[model samples]
Target: MFTTIHRWGNSQAVRLPKGILETASLRENDRVEITAEYDRIIIRKATKKHLTIEERFEGYNGDYRCKEADTGGPVGNEEW
Candidate 1:
């Protein structure tokens, strides 16, 4: 089947039919890759790797410290 191409804002677009999207296993926010070979264009889903929080932070150790409170009286006309 063929679909009409239309101008969207400053770009060209073609609305994908629901059946086509479903058959391609594509969903909302899914990443896709498009490539052109000679006179034909091909679009496919992008391969992505999902990592857990722990997997993302598998690194060396680091140190962090909090500042100590100053108990001195106000030295300026700043609001308390």
Candidate 2:
């Protein structure tokens, strides 16, 4: 399979075929890491890091209070 590199605005872009994407388990809007090694370009899916709840709120001072907000009443067919 072959593809042509086209000028997209200010950068060069290559359109990967559907088969290639499927083989790599890649989807549209997926994050990828691109690197150039010698004369070849490599593309790989970016790994996501999962943070625990404690890690996510490492610097919190616990000063938040939950409040009920008035939504101007229900408009359509609400059982409330």
lDDT of each: 0.84, 0.93
In order of appearance, the predictions have TM-scores of 0.58, 0.62
Q: Write the per-residue lDDT of candidate 2 for residues 3-30, one digit (tens) a residue.
A: 9999999999999999999999999998
Off by over 4 Å in 2: 49-80
Error of 2 at 12 (Å): 0.5
- Residue pairs clashing in model 2 are none
lDDT of 1 by residue, 1-80 (tens): 89998999999888899899999999877878889999977878987666688878778355657799998887789649
Scored by lDDT, model 1 comes in at 0.84
Best by TM-score: 2
Candidate with best lDDT = 2
Quote model 2's TM-score. 0.62
